[model samples]
Target: MIKETFSKNTRINKKVCLTTDFVIAGGGLAGVCAAITAARAGTKVILVQDRPVLGGNASSEVRIWALGATSHMGNNNRWSREGGVIDEIMLENLKTNKDGNPLYFDAILLDKVSAEQNITLLLNTAAYQVNKSLDTKIDSIDAFCSQNSTHYTISAPLFCDATGDGLVGFNAGASFRIGAESREEFGELLASEDESNQILGHTLFFYSKKVDHAVTYKAPSFAYSHEEIGANPRSKNIHGHDSGVKFWWVEYGGIRDTIYETEEIKWELWKIVYGIWDYIKNSGQFEDVDNLTLEWVGTVPGKRESRRFNGEYMLKQQDVVEQTNFYDAISFGGWAIDIHPSEGIYSEKPACSQFHSKGVYQIPYRCFVSKDIDNLYFAGRNISATHMAYGSTRVMITCAHGGQAVGEAAAMCKDLSVSPKDLLEKELIHQLQQRLNRFGHGIPGVALDKSANKVSFANIFASSELVLKNYESCGDYVSLAQSAAQLIPLKKGNAPIVSINIIAERDTEIVCQLRTSEKPENYTPDIINKTISLPVHAGKQTIEFDFTDVDVIDQYGFVCFLANQYIQLEISTQLVSGTMSVFNKVHKAVSNSGRQEAPANSGIEEFEFWTPERRPKGQNLAVSFDPPLPAFSKDNVVNGHLRPWLNSNAWVSDYADTQPTLKITWQEKVELSEITLFFDTDYDHALETVLMQHPESEMPYCVKSYRIRTAEGKLLADVNNNYQTVNTLTLDSSITSQELIIELDHPSSDVPAALFEIQVR
Candidate 1:
């Protein structure tokens, strides 16, 4: 506005130089989680993102829904949601935007990052250059923001490359692989026969809405014709009702270079999308799409695979498929080994080939540390893994979960003045896991350290504990169109005597099997301990199946009822915590076919899939247990576990206990500066980040109202409408109390009050 100045040589845009303890390049869910986790652990963090908004693919620009272990509840990993910062983010999104608007999710991420005082968020800044002080250590990162025309030079002792494409790691000359490795390379059964350049491609999504008036569309000249697309055998799936992520198969560029030809891939996707829309509008294939209009289309394609940087250890196919327990385990993943066709949408092959392990597998910390760059860490889809293993670890939420592990390692490294590799020492790794678990991060087979909690020394008691009894049938009957099973927790001994109400169309002999997982931690019903046949009458009647003679271990017993459409099982409204009913059903979206049909010699086992039904219909099957199963003990709160695993690792009060109370008494008056309470938010629920809508804003199992008090009944804190899994109460000052009391209210009339863990510091 004042004057225009011309430079004789070159004009330098606004330049900024900042220093932090940790620098994270990328603002995707992984980077966001890393930044948030590091910052929360008292580390200065700088987060750089090329996009104007955070949440990369999960942002509105791309609109890919966030998913992790739950895998749309299509697999056998029950209560397997990734914990830590990502869980908090997902829970927050569920509370405020259960409808899963991408914009709302974007805001939530931005809000969370911005709230962190120690985080310096640089949006629209792309990291293009890496400055190294040594051959094995990154010194600084050079990034530029096109929107502001500014350059940022950020230096940090630690750096996390979560850019998805491994931009920072690539520029830093970190060891990486660009394509699939041969089966012999890692001895992977799922790997290709030989090394190949072909990889998963980029995908774009579009959102359409129904309008009041009829809408017309004209296809662009570049758009493919209906006939051109019809040449593909899968074209029949194109429907007006299906848009956005539902058209995940409308992809391309796997045959080409996804990194360099992003624009080309995007154009092809656009053409495919437009061609699909045109086919629905004018081809007379869809009957009711006149009022439908495209609301939004992604500008950039959501990338699936690219350069995977090598870490100290490259995760291989067997690690995931075998549920390998690494010595330095830091995180876990449960998504299937999902590999896509190299030809993408044009291919005759299925969109994706997926194979699931029996249970969730641990991800070691070494996979997050760079093998070449000492100061560099990997996150998101770029983390070290072979092509076959990457197929499972590449999901957004899973990447975010591993990001948390590296983030905490970064913080600990700074505190100890050591590199990430040094933390691999047995004691140090345990400490790191302890720190992660303290912040609500879940690691398979790892429990919170009891020595760190003052409550571990105290005696705990509760007003009442829930005893498995009877689920009052709500008059809801589900036709046994498919085999169904109720997962019941049992101790080592005889199985419980169970009775179920079934309505039979005609007199028939119903077969019931008592099954359990081969592994105690898994939910897969792979072992059948007993099979019983009960003759039932035509009308509604209760049938008793006694398994008191059947020996069992401390695991979940799958009480299975074979498929018989002639019979209908009674459903109950009693939605208890940790207990669920699953069906051998197909969820076509996640490639679940009721059973996995792996080819012989594929190294993958064929097993039946028992997945829970989504709510509004996934009520528990009504059943009664003789000599009620002794579970949900109050002492479970001090058991060091945070979520439901082999059992309901929670202190769940009886449904009849209106004002559930827990007491912690100390031998001597102890000083407590802080008290942390872990609640049940139903970790089993998959809170999809976008597109999909959830039935409830808050988890029905969460303790909505609670009060903390001293022995004298002096209120310390009164919390209401609580919806989060973790609630930390930092007292104004250290309180000296010999006895503490916690009063809880049931989240709903039907749901009981449950608390997973309690810690005093």
Candidate 2:
């Protein structure tokens, strides 16, 4: 039994000694992800969040939208997202908090921590005191809960400092750098010419909502009008129409110590917020929104940079631009080498400067592990990165991924009874990458394991699936046949044909004639199933066709497009990503050399892709299936590729199906306890932008209601109204079965049923 003493300040005077495998400080997305990852790997963890809620900057008090590999869609990151735990959290946000309500977001973060059995979350607790051993290891951490003034002494084998400001790192006397380094230090073109402490400043934001009645405002004494603020380019972009993220330029305190002068900076920012609202509401400059009222304003400032710990490697700008392939890579960052003016909102020039990379660059495992301290590991904004590199890696989602990598590394350390650096030295890094892949994380050059499913892995490249396939350009398309026809691979037989997607330009009806290739060599449509005419529209849209009206029985491969002029197909570029095409005789492709593949189908009408130089890759239609198995070109579900749609991706069931059921079977009986399901929550949608009100929920094809059963027809687990992108279901008792059936009774939205991966492990 533990004894406690009450103090006059309503604090517990007793010494609370607790032990855990991993102790994580900070409650932001990064810290949250670290705790979640370690706990999920079968370890006891104590997560300390300084604030009353989780999600540090993303919390209700400081509402900065999370950004990462996608770079808020501004960096041209075609289908990239921070995979693994961050993907799970983001998808959950897309499903429930479509409006990006900070309050609901706070709940989501809290619920995730609470749902995990091994995580003991300490909200409103600050880890202020640290005890370091003489051997340069973190022995224990002391945290103070201000609400009750209770002190906790937590001892753990490993400590993760995810505190965005690196509080624990500083407290533990870790080697860290303060601000920008000279260009000579790293050879970064964008690096400051001289050594300086000019770091990215803290920012504050406010939300505005229009009320039914006219709303009025009373400006504070320090409020400054737009004209008075003068010469700030960010002012032009600031309007009632803009969301909070747009006001990231409302920042200050870069010249001062970020940790020491935070309060002073926040006070100045408060005046800016009220002043900006006064300009928008009181000043007659902008039109409309006379009834607009300030919904909420942040009291605490959202910090950008502070003390970055020194590790084995300090990532530089060239590494990102050149797409450096680090051997010890644990994660990848696609966000550009972004930099901001030190003067923040007051700067006369542009607020930010962004430079994109040809592709995502790797984040090495050495960056997070301490160079000197054996047990001290840190992630998030404080991880080892040059100031220029930190600009891109500091986004919340990227930090979250970093946290996950650090947490997983910590768990591995606990298991091996070795330090993080020693584990890497032991050449156990591949195990980490494999585990990251298994968790659905996309580490470039790392592929998902296909041996578990035993099914042959076949599909298009990663760049095939368009991120946002909407009423807009539903990704790119390529005419595989050039007589204006295309082919889609059929994954399995006896699977009823539900519908096929065709492209059109105008609101005219066109006939979609389906025909199976004869002799497995003729690429031309040999057996015509049925000619169904459907009305087509401008931009890319789907045209549905059913096979029940036709007579051909066995299995047929490929579908040809037949329409008058005006419709065009979209496909990926050939110079970078190569695609394969099927033609009747002489094959034509998107190529400069007029390159053609050996004729597989001979003696038929002309078949050509036209451009031989173009890779002819990821160029396919969004088709649907009944008794749905998987599409041939894009086998999102069955195929082992389980990251975002950046790679040719996704398994969609089309608009015709209301509820879809999936059945998984193996060659032999296997013990089954856990079932993981990754849903299609529409990666094409954007979330980190300055939202106008709360936007509509992302159109996700999630299984709203589901049930799991065994081969013996016994109900293993039944879940109704499921809303998770990564749905994990466990049975009461371990069952040995060769087959498992999943019935998706309802969908979260009006979209098709899609699954990234249904990992049996």
lDDT digits (tens) for residues 650-712 of candidate 2: 555444445455666667777777777766543433456225233445433455666778778
Error of 1 at 374 (Å): 0.8
lDDT value for model 1? 0.90
Tens-digit lDDT track of model 1 for 433-473: 99999878989999988888988899988999999898888
RMSD of each: 1.1, 11.6
State the RMSD for candidate 2: 11.6
Candidate 2 least-lDDT 10 residues: 587-596
lDDT of each: 0.90, 0.67
